[model samples]
Target: MKIIPLGIWGGYPKANSATSSFLIEDKGFHLLLDCGSGVLSSLQNYISIDELDAVILTHFHHDHVADIGPLQYSKLIQSQLNNDVKTLPIYAPNHEKDFFQKLTFNKHTKGKVLEENKEYAIGPFVIHTIKTTHPAYCLAIKLTVEGQSVVFTADTEWFVELGSFSSMVDLLISESNLYKSFEGQIPGHMSGRQAGLLAKEAKVKKLILTHLPHFGELNQLVAEAKQNYKGEVEIAKVGKSYFLSN
Candidate 1:
C-alpha cells in the first residue's frame, strides 16, 4: 500500500503544501481521504477528478471538505465525455450527509452514509470508523488492505482513545497541527508531541505528521515530535509520495 499526499498544511496556507488531501493506493484501487480547498488545484496535478474511486470525508470543515462541491460537479460534467464513466461514491459521517446533499444541489443523490463502528468495504480495503474529538463530529478511519493496515486521524486533540483506536496499523497518518510547548490551549487540535506519543503507544511502523500549524517553526515542531517518538517520523509535505509494503 502507498499513500500519496496531494496537500499537507494546517489551518493556514504554505508555499507548496495544500490543506489536507491523501490518496491511498493498494492492489490497483485508489481511495481519496479528503478534498480541501488547498488541494483543489493540486488534484489535477496528480489524477483526474474523475479517476477517483471514492472519497471518504472525515468531517465537514471547510479546510477538510472544501473541494467536494467542485470535484463532484466536475465529475458529473465529465461523465458526458465518456459513457462508461461512473459517479464516484462518497462516504462520510452521517452528520455530514446534509453537507453532501447541499453539494449535490439536490439533483444528484445516492451516496453511502457511514454509521459509527460499522465496517464498509471498498475495493480491496476494509474501512472502519471511530469517532474523534473535533469541533464537528469526525470519524477516524482505519483501512486494512491485504495484510497491511493504515490509520488516519482526521483532526482531533490528544486523547487516550486515539492510541487505542490506531492500534496495529502499519502506517499512521495523523494531524500534528500545533508545535510542542505552545503557551495557550488551541483547542480542537493536536500538538506534535501529542501525535508522537500516540504513535509511540500505538506501535505504528511509521508516523507521518501533517496539518502543520499555520504559524510556527516547522523545525521545532518536527524536533518535538521526534523527542517523543522513537519510530520513523516525518513532516509530510505536498507532492511527496510514500511507498509501503507488507
Candidate 2:
C-alpha cells in the first residue's frame, strides 16, 4: 500500500500549503482519505480527477471536506467530456444528515453512510471506522491491504480508547494540531506529545505527524514527540509518499 500526503495543514491552509488531505492507493485503486481546503488543486498535481476511485471523509468539518464541491464539479466536467463517468462513492458518517446531503448534491458524487466499528471493502482496501471524540461527530479510519495496516487518527482529543483502536498498525498518521504547551487549551485536537504517546501505546511501526497547525515551530513539535516516542517519526510533507509492504 502507498500513501501520499496531499495537504498537511490544519484549520486553514497556509500561503503555499493546504488543509488535511491524503491519497491512499493500492493495487491500481486510488482512494482519497479527505478533501480539505485547496486540496483539489494539490490533488491535481498528482492525479487527474477521473483517476480517483472513491473518497472517504472522517467528518463534516470544513477543514476536512471543504473541497467536496470543487471535486464534484471537476468530476461533472470530466463526465461531460468523456460520457463514461461513474459516480464517485464517498463514504462518510451518517450523523450529519444535512451536511451529507450537501456533499452529495452533485450528480457525479454519491455519499454512503459509514457505520461505527463496521468494516467495509473498497477495492483492495478493507476499511474500519472508529468513532472519535471531537466537537462534531468524527471517525478515525483504519485501512488494511494485504495484511498491512495504516491507521489515521483524523481529528480528536487525547482519548484512552485510541490506543486499542490503532493497535499494532504499520503506520499511524495522527493529527497533531497542538504542541505540549497548549494541551488542554484546545478541546478537540491532540497535542504533539499526545500523538507520540498514542503511537507508543499502539506500538505502531512508524508515526507520521500531520494536520499541523501553522503557528508553532514544527521542529519543536518533532522534538516534543521524540521525547515520548522512541520509534521512527516523520513530519508529514505535501506530495511525499510512504509505502508499506506485507
Candidate 3:
C-alpha cells in the first residue's frame, strides 16, 4: 500500500500548498482521503480525477471538502468526453444533509452516508470510522489492507479513546495543528506534544504529523513531537509518498 500527501496544511492553504488531501493506493485501486482547498489541482499531479475509485471525507469543513465541487465538475467534463463514464463514489458523514445533497447536484458524483463504526469495503481496503472531537461532525478513519493497518486522526482535540482507537497500527497520520505554547487555546485541534503523546500511547510503528498550521515553525513541531514519542516521526510534505509493507 502507498499513501501520498497531496496537501498538508490545515484551516487554509499556504503559498504553493493546499489543505488536507491524501491519496491512498493499493494494486490498481485509488482512494482519496480528503478533498480540501486547492486539492483538485494538486491531485492531477499524481493521477487524473476521473481515475479515483472512491473519496472518504473526514468532515464538512471548507478546508476539508472545498474541492468537492470542482472535482464533481471535472468528472462531469470527463463524462461529456466519454459516454460510459461512471459517477465517483464519495463517502461522508450523514449529519450534514444539505452539504451531501449539494455534492450530488450532477450525475458526475454519488454521495454515500457514512455511519459511525460501520465497516465499508472499498476495493482493497476495509475502512472503519469513529467520531472525533471537532467543531463540526468529524470522523477519524482506520483503513486495513491485507494485514497492514493505518489510522488517520483527521482533526480532533485530545481524547483518551483515541489512544486505543489507533493502537498498534502501522502508521498514524495525525493532525498536529498547534504548538505547545498554544495548546488548549483552541478546542478542536492537537498540539505537537499532544500528538506525540497520543502516538506513544497508541504504539504505532510510524507517526506522520499533518494538517500543520502555516504560521508555526515546521522544525519546532517535529522536535516537540519527538520529546514524547521515541519512535520514527516524520512531518508530512506535499507530494511525498510513504510505502507500507506487510
Candidate 4:
C-alpha cells in the first residue's frame, strides 16, 4: 500500500503547501482521503482524477471537501465520453449527508455517505471511522491493508483517548499544525508536541506529521515533536508517495 500526500497545508493562503488531501493507493485501485481546494491540480501529477475508486472525506470544511464538486464533474464528463461505468463513492460524516446530496448532480443519483464510528471495506482495505474534535463534522480514519495499518487524524486537538484509535498501527499520519506556544488555545488543531504524545501512546511504528501551519519555523516544530516521541517521524511532503510493507 502507498500513501501520497497531495497537499499538506494546515489552512491555505500561504504558498508553502496547499490544504488537506491525500491519495491512498494499492496496486491499480486508488482511494482519496480528503479532496480539498488544491487537490485536483496536485492529483494530475499522479493519476487522472477520473480513475479514482472512491473518496473518503473526513469533514465538510472547505479545506477538505472543496474539490469534490469539480472532481465529480470531471468524472461525469469522462464517464460519458469514454463510455465508462466508473462511479465515485463518497463516505463522509452524517453532517455532510444533506450537503453532498444537494451538491451531487442528478437528483436521482445516489452517493454513499456514512456516519462516524462506522466500518466499511474498499478493495483490499478495511476502514474504520472515528470521530474527532473539530469545528465542523470531522473524523479520523484507520485503514488496514494487507497486514499493515495506517491511521489518519484529520484536524484534531490533543485528546487522551486518540491513541486508542491508532493502536499498533504501522504508520500514524497525524497533524502537527501549531507550535507549543499555541497548544490548548488553538482549539481544533493539535501542536507538534501533542501529536508526538499521541503517537507515543499508540505505540505506532512511524509518525508522519502533516498539515503544517502556514507560518512559523518548521524545524522547531519537528524538534519539539521529537522531544516527546522517540520513534521514527517524518514530515509529510507534497507530491511524495510512501510505500508501506510490513
Q: What lDDT does candidate 2 reach at residue 128? A: 92
How much is the lDDT of residue 62 in candidate 1?
83
Give the root-mean-square deviation of each candidate in angstroms. Answer: 2.0, 1.0, 1.0, 1.9
Alpha carbon lDDT at 73, candidate 1: 70
Worst 10 residues of 3 by lDDT: 100-109
Distance (Å) between predicted and true CA of 44, model 3?
0.5
For candidate 4, list the clashing residue pairs, or say none. Answer: none
Model 1 sits at a Cα RMSD from the real structure of 2.0
TM-score of each: 0.92, 0.98, 0.98, 0.93
Q: List the residue pairs that clash in candidate 1.
A: none
**Model 3 C-alpha RMSD to native:** 1.0
Residues 50-118, candidate 3: write the lDDT tens digits.
789999999999999999988888887788787636878899997989998876746778888888878
| 49-124: candidate 4 lDDT, tens digit per residue | 6678878888887888787788777877777788666556777776755776744565212367666777888878
- Write one digit per residue (lDDT tens) for candidate 2, span 1-246: 999999999899998778988999988999999888999899888888899999999999999999999988888888788994588999999898998887674568899889889999999999998899999899999999989999999999988988999999999999999999899998899988889999999999989999998886897778888888999888998888899996
By lDDT: ranked, best first: 2, 3, 4, 1
Candidate 1 worst ten-residue window by lDDT? 102-111
Please, what is the whole-model Cα lDDT of each candidate in the order they appear? Answer: 0.78, 0.90, 0.90, 0.82
Give lDDT: candidate 4, residue 82.
81
TM-score of 2: 0.98
lDDT by residue for model 1 (1-246), tens: 778888888664577557877888777777888878767678777777766777888888888888777876776667656653565777887685568566443333246687778799988889988888888888889988777888889898877887988997888998888877762377778988888888889989989888777776777767787887898888886677787675
